[model samples]
Target: MNSKLVILGGGAAGVLIAMKLASQNIDVTLIDSKTFYEYTPALCSVLYEETDAKFHQHFSEISFELEPFLRKINVEFILGNAKLIKDDKVFIHQREEGIEYDYLVICTGSSYADPWKTQNGTECIDLNRRINFLNEQREKYKQAQHILCIGGGPVGVEVATEISYRAPGKKITLVDMNKTVLANAPDGIGNNAQRILNARDSITSIMEQSASQKGQEGNTYIYETDKSHTEIKADLVYNCIGVTPNSEFLQANHADWLNEKKQIIVDPGLRVTSNVFAVGDVNSVNEPKMFYTAHMQAIHFVRNMSRIIKNNTNVENLIPYHPSRPNMIVSMGPQYAIGYVSGIKLTGWPLGLNKGSHLASWGKYTIERITMNSCHLKIPVNEVLYLTSRP
Candidate 1:
C-alpha cells in the first residue's frame, strides 16, 4: 500500500512542505481554507504605495504551475479546513464532504485577535482592511489638528511614520507604555527610529503613563497608564499592538501538543506527536515570527520527511532549524526606510529602495521559480515505512 501524507494550511510553510514531499513521490495532499495566498509582508508596503496591491494573487495560479510537476510525482491538492485528527487519519470539512489522511502536517497560519468586546467582533487580518482603516483615519483627521497612535512596536512606529509623512499638517503623537519603541529590536534601531520620527515637523514621541480623560466632550482619545495620565486632543487613534498565534483549532482538539503560549511544541526534527509536524508562526521557536524563518522551518521539515521516505540512515542528522540572520526592511514611507542586513545597519533611500525592490521582486519571481524547480521528483513508499517504523 502507498503511504499517505497530508498537509494542513496552505500558507508558505504548508505549500513549501507539500511541494517538497510531492517532489519525492510521497503521495502528498495539501489543504487550506482560502484559495488565495496573500503576501502578508507586502501588505504594509502596498498600503504605503511602495508596491502594487495586484501583486497578491490567487493560489490557484500557483497550484496550476505545480500541477504538471506534482502529477509527475503523484501528489494531489485538496481545498478544505482540517477539523480533527484521530489515530493516523485526519478529518477535513469543506462544503459538506469529509476526508481523511494517514500522516498529517499542520500549518494553519494565524489570524488577528478581535479587538472589540464582543466575541464576534470585527477583526482586521488583510492588507486592504488595514489600508482602508488608515485612509479613513486620515480623512477623519484632516479637519482636526492632532492624531494619536497607540503601541510602539514596529507596526506602531511604521504606521505613525507613514501618517506623519502623508499628513504634514496634523500633529502625530506616538504613545507607548514601554521606555522606548521597538523594544525587542537592537539598541540603536529604536533610538534611530525615534530620531527619524522626531525630525519630522508633525511627529512627537511621548513616553509616559497612558492618557486619561478629564472630560469626555471633545474629540480626543485618552489612554490611562501607570505613572500619570496625559490627554491629547486627537481626531483619530490607530492601535498596532502585537500578534498572537493562530491555534484555536489546536486548542480545541489536541491541546496536549501545545505549550503555555498555545504554540505547538515540535521535536528537534520539527515533528510533533506521532507522524505529525508543525511549522510557521503556529509553532514555538526561538526566532521572531517572520516569513523567511517560517519558510526555512518548512524546508527543514520537508528534507527530514524525504529522508524517512528514502530509508536514509542519517534522517536524525538532518539540518537543524536556525533563526535567519537579523535582517529587517522597515519602510518609513515611500522614500525612507531603516534596517540591518548582513550585520550592516542601513538608513534612508538606499534602505528604502533596496527593500522595496527586494520585496516586490521576491514576490514576482523568486518564490515561484523556487517552487517550480523544487516540486518535481518521485520516491518509493517502502523506504519511508522501513526507515520510520518503530523497531
Candidate 2:
C-alpha cells in the first residue's frame, strides 16, 4: 500500500509542498482551515490605497492551472483545521467530520502577536478591516489631527508611511522602543529607511525607552517610559509589533518537537521528525521569516520528500538548504519604492519601475503555477534556480 502524506495549512508553504509531493505519484492530502489561499503581501499595498479595498483574490482564480493538475495527481484537498497528530496519524477536525493521515507536514505559519493573546479573539483576515478600523477611529475624533504608530519594524514603518501618504494633512508619529527601525536588518537598509521616513513632511519618529502603559481613546494615547510618563493626542493608534509561530496543534502530541519560542525545530533537510516535516514561519531557522524564505523552504522540502518516496536512501543529502542573501522591496506610495537586491540598494523611480514591472507580477504568478504544477509535474530546481537568477 502506498503511504499517505498529509499536509496542514493551505498557505504558501503547505500548498507548495503538497503540489510537489503529489506530482511524484505519492498519496497526498492537503488540509487547511479555509478553502482559498489569501495573498498577504498585498496587504501593505492596500493600506496605502495602491490596491483596491476588496482586492482579496482567490487562490483558484490566481492559479487556474492548478485545478487540472490536482485532479490529474488525485491529490485530496480538505478544508478543515488540523487539531493534533497522534500515533503518527494526523487528527483533522472539519466542520462536522474527522479524518486521519499517515505522514504529516506542518506549515501552519504565524499569527500576529497582539496584546490580547491571553484572551480569545478573532484573527484579522484582510487589509480592508485594518484600514476600516483606522478610518473609524479617525472619524470618531474629526478634530484630532495626529496619528501614532507604535513599533519600528517593517510593518510599523509601512503602516506609518501609508497613513502619511493617504492622509498627508494628519500628523503621524512613529515610535519604537528600540533605537532604530529595521533593527534586525543590515545597517544600510535601516539607515535608508530612517532617512526616507525623516524626509517625509508628515511623519515624525522617536525612540522610546520602554513600551509601558497602553490604551488609546479618541485623541489621547498614554504610554510610560523609563524616565517618565508620556501621553500623545492622536486620532488613531496602530500596532505592528511582530508575529508568533502558530504551533498550538502540536502542543499535545509533538511538544518535544517545538522550540522555546513555539517554533517547530526542523533539521537541515526541513524534516521535523521521522517521516514528518515543517516549513514556513512555523519552522525555526536562522533566516528571517519572510515569504521568500518560506517559498524556498517549501520547494526544498517537497524535493526531498519526492526523493524519499522513490526509495532513495540518500534523499536527505540531495540538497542542503542554504539561506539566501536578504532581498526586499518596500513601497512608500503608489509610485515610490525602495529595494535591496543582492546587497545593492536602490530607491526612487527605478525602484518603482521594478516594483510595477510585469515581470515581478508574473514572478509571483509563476510561483503559484509551479506550486500547483508540483502536484503533477516534476520541474527540476536547477531550471527554476536558473530562470529566477536571470536578469
Candidate 3:
C-alpha cells in the first residue's frame, strides 16, 4: 500500500511539497480553506494603473485554481478546514471519518491585516469573488483623494508606491512607529527606501509615529497620532500593520506544540511530532519570512520526507535543515527598487542611474514568473513585456 501523506494549507510551501511528492509512491492529499493559490508577493500591484505597461493584474490572472492544479499532478485536493488533529486521524469540517495519514505536514501560512489577504474570516470561495472585491477596492481608492497607510514594511511601502505611480495627485501618508522604513532590514535598505519615499511628491513619510483610528465621520476617517497628538484625517486607510499565523486549529489540542506567537515549534528536521511536520511562515524557524524562504523550506521538507519513507517511517536518518540569510528586493515604484544580496546592498538600477529609473520591478517580475512556472503555470507575454519593461 502507498504511504498516505496529508498536507495542510495550499500556500507556497504546501503546494510545492505536493507537486514534488506527486511523482513518488506516496498518496498525497492537500487540504486548504481556499480554492485557489494566490501569488501574494504581487498582491499590492493590484492597485497599479491599468495600462499596457502595468505592474498590477486582476486577481484571477495571478491566482491558480488549487483543486485542478493538484488534480493534474495526481494529488487529491480537499476544500475544508483542518478542525482537529488527534493521534493519526485528522478531522476536517464536514468530513466525518477524518483522514488517517502516515505523515502530516502543516504549512498553513500567515494572514495579513488587509482584507485582500483574507475576506470575512476565511478566503473567498472562488475566483470571481476575489476579482470583484479587488475591483471594489480599486474603485474606492480612485475616488479617495487622501489615503493613509500604517506600516513601513514591504507591503506598506509597495502599496504606497503603487498608488503614487497610479495617481500622483492622491495624498499618501505613510506612518511607521520605527525611526525609518524597513527598520528590520539592513541600514542601507532602510535609508534607500526612506530616500525613495521622500522623493515622491504625493507621499508623506511620518516616521516614529503611531496612529489610532478615533472614528469615522461621513467620508473622512479621523485618527490621533501617539507622539505628536496631532489629528490625521484620511478618505481611505490601509492597516498594513501585523501578520498573524493561521494556526488556531492547533491551539485546542496541541498548545504545547506552538510558540508564544502561535507558530508551530519544529525540530531541526522540521518535525512538530514524530509523524508530523511544519514549514513556511507557520513554523518557528529562524529565517526571513519571505516567499522564497518558504519555497526553500518546502524543498528541504521533501528531501527529509523522501528519506523517512525510504527507511520505513524512520526519522532518525533524516537530514537537518539549516537556514541562511536570504536575498531581498524592495521596489519603491515601477521605476525604482533596492535589494540586499550576499551581504551587499544593491540599487534598483545597476548602472548608477537616477533614483526614479530603478529597474527593481524587472527582478520582481522575473521572480514572480519563476514562482508561477514552478507550479506548471506560465504567464503569457503578449501585451505585457516581461523582460524589457520597467515594471
> Top model by TM-score, which number?
3
**Cα lDDT computed for each candidate against the true fold:** 0.58, 0.62, 0.78
Model 3 lDDT, full chain set: 0.78
For every candidate in turn, the CA RMSD to the true structure comes to: 7.8, 5.7, 5.2
TM-score of each: 0.72, 0.77, 0.90
lDDT tens digits, residue span 285-375, model 2 = 7788876677777777776776777865463464556765676655555445455655655554344332232333344444444544445
The most accurate candidate by lDDT is 3
Residue 228 of model 1: what lDDT? 54
lDDT of 2 at 108: 87
In terms of lDDT, which candidate is stronger, 1 or 2? 2
Model 3 TM-score on a 0 to 1 scale? 0.90
Give candidate 3 misplaced runs (Cα > 4 Å).
51-58, 119-124, 349-357, 374-391
